[model samples]
Target: MPGQETDRRPLSAAQLGVWYAQRLDPASPVFNQGGHVDLHGPIDVPLFAEALSRLVAEDGTTRLRFTEAGGVPAQFAAAVEPYVPEIADLRDTPDPEAAARELIDADMATVPDLEQGPLFRHLLLRLGEDRLRWYYRAHHLMQDGFSGHLLQRRLGEIYTALAGGTESGPALGPVSALLDQHDVYRDSAARKKDRAFWSRVMEGAECPPARAGRPALRIAREISFISSEQFAALREFGVRAGVSWQQVLIGAGVLHQHRRTGARDVLLSLPVTGRLTPAARRVPGMSANVLPLRVAVDPDATCEALMARVASAVLRVQWHQRYDASELIRDLGWPADGRRQFGPVVNVLAGDAPPRFGGVPGTAHLLSTGGTAEDLGITVTDGPDGGLRVDFTVDAAYADSVPLASHRRSFHRVLDTLTGDADVPVREVDVLDGVEWGLVVEEWNNTAVPIGQETLNTLFEHQARIHPDHTAVIFNDEHTTYRRLNENANRLAHHLTHCAGIRRGDLIGVLHDRSTTFATTLIALTKTGAAYTVLDPDFPDTRLNTTLTRNHITTVITDTNHTHRITAPHLIHTDHDTHHHNHPAT
Candidate 1:
């Protein structure tokens, strides 16, 4: 405690990343992390408060205050008063649970003042005689999801000892211990190696497909749980395939992205607990780093092969997981332009189990995990009933733009596929369920309508009779009335039949520019009961010749400018005067 207030140290790389993010949007509470623990049976509120205070005093991270020292962000342990839980007797209110939830939400929405000392809050609500809810909220710069669980476990240990009239376990190590460990690693040769490994992994990588909306702090969450039977099947499959369930989940995520976006190479942010050293693990501060797992999916390969690939990538990432992702971004020269390097985050929360409270039945419920930089996050954790729970936190700005329910269903279908046949090809895995399939393939594609048997030429003639003086064609600032267009087409048809011996069922080639003459030629050909093949003037001569020969077209109608491009045995120029005399007046 000698340098408690005076000793200022540079933030750890993880904390520094969060510091910059918070500074970018100081007023947004998107960086606030919060959760609540519902205790079914609890009584000693006073003892609980004392235990929390003692825990706060022992953990140096709880007393940390951040400020800019010499124009650089630094953190120091402040000798502040011990943190006390704000007790609320909500038992008398109508719907005490609802009241407590509202309180927690309001506190989580508050933006913490980084320089003003305390960056965390504790609230204890009494719902009934035996029911209680304990809420905790902290800034991301102070703690992460792992640290949150650590603090809860330690607090439970202290509270249990106090209640049992026994000595508590050893206290959490000081924050400086982790800080020193980080400093040593930062300047170590291993750091250089990590940088190189990450550089190689991220080489030739581009940002994931852009999401629907801009980056916003507010989020919409959808929570669902996998059935115990399905989870069991998944675990069994993983075991037989020699991979962990976590890897299977990650592979499923990659497959989902591939199926969703059709991107062969998919990138997902995998959150790694940056507790490489014992000190970093024991201190319980901000020690989480996100690793970009780039999975190259081969659609032709089996799902088992994809899982093996994912497992290998995950193992490699775990080996080099100490490197901070923010540092990697800076080293890679990626600008902070709000474009995400990875798609949805595939987070596997396998370790942070619910903390025990003096043999009391308590359930942990996460309220918020701060604002997500990525548009979507997929969190997989152990469900309450021996199953797996998946929570999707999507950007609120894109909640309407994105299909959350459909995505959930798609991911579930992927999980089902993984749990069933390992030999299924990646491309053959169906993401959509039957209902979604119907929507996409049947309902959405329902475009059929009854149609008369009138041919194109007859329809045009009917329209011309009804609107003779109306403009029927407009090209290059010239307009032709329906009557004149019909007359011209009739004359051309008569000329083709009488002079060129053109008859029904003949395949005629129309080689012309996109002009009124082309329209006239098509109508004339249709009037003669002959099918016309369009030969673009822009096409090469070889292609034109191929089209004519392939269609067995001996006669072709062309304009004066394009007459040389046609290779038909006989050619009739639209501008030629020879055919004009053969046609009768219409």
Candidate 2:
């Protein structure tokens, strides 16, 4: 039998953030966090349902109903029916695993009701005679990554005790205990100190530009793994360097961002488990917060130096991890606009051992961590065979800009360098592997074609002969036909060769008032087989003289407006010349 609903209580800081985000997009499935575990050997269906129901009844966070009181959002613990696993016998399907996956994805896509009760769901699928999969999903307001693990571990304990006829451990602490922990810390002196510390640290920090357009609930993931041998070497190196393995990974991530954006100051949003006290850790609820971790990268320094800095920063942040980020935003008076305060997030999920159910071997697989507001999120977990598994989640809008596969490969290359040698300069670490280098340097740049040895004047003459009546140039709204322009150039060439005695290999200077005559003068100089240099009318007299003297230019052609600036020995004026014949000059 179920009891009456309890009185409404104020939401926690984390729950309040989730509440506003869901209200903004009520139909978004981004708030749903889901995963499944494959159990081998055997599973008792009825017994498993009883275990799950017991787990749900003991965890009050699972029965929370969200609603608005007056104008502020709040939550109340509602007495709801016991949660029984929905059984899907997929053994008759052609591909049981595939069918199960399709059904799970479709169910995850459906939005959960917030105002009513039951913010979580459970499903069980029979894949084979001896294999079964248990799926669980919950709204972010009720559970986080840590809470999800807690629930799974507790469920296994209950099932094992029922089968062995033994006593199980104590159930989870009441949700009110977690609430009391939050209330005690709200007005404590430690919080004021933390607020002051964060205020100083984020004094001049500006929000980074959004990696994708308007933040959507859609996400894209790419998963990769590192060899166990490499991971061992990395751990040994961490021991030698007096830093934890997580710090080394954080350093690698900071170096990666520095290489990509070339920013000396890199800020990453690190998701922290806000369960510092014993009471908070014992309860399964949303006690997670994301804080900014700022690292100043110096390319000239060694990799070990950066790791040392990261270790120190991590120590300081963990001490003050309970401070709510949203309150810090208010303290700093930042705008409510939806801009991210950091770049890519580097989430390191370590120390999660595999769970067993009643002497059956089981493996856990995460499907989604809810929709990420950050463009890039990297999650590093412990692999099954003692290696390292890295999962990259990206916003679909930013996929084209940052290719998931290439980014993963490049990050792996950086990790390899970090694990191999700490003496290497941060700038020397190559993001591209050998194959990517070959593609970029050799294949992509393989653009070459044979060149024809045709001079500019000869090419112009050929075009004029072919398209004689076509307009060749337009200057100041005046169009000149190719034939007419060629005739003008020929007359100027004849005047320059015979009248001024200009010859091949001579350097001629042209000072012009940007008109059609400038083009005619250039073509005429080329017709005489002499090189020409352009002298702008805007140049000073001294610069013009220096250019003419340096180039050994003796002859000068000018329009009337710029003649005053040319002091060369020989002078030819296009506007003053009277040669108008239409014959080519020899």
The digit string of per-residue lDDT tens for model 2 on 497-524 reads 8888889988888887677777888898
Clashing pairs in 1: 30-371
Instruction: Give the lowest summed-lDDT range of ten residues in model 1.
Output: 577-586
| Residues 524-563, model 1: lDDT tens digits | 8899998888876644466678878887899888877777
Model 1 whole-model lDDT (C-alpha atoms): 0.80
Q: What TM-score does model 2 achieve against the real structure?
A: 0.72
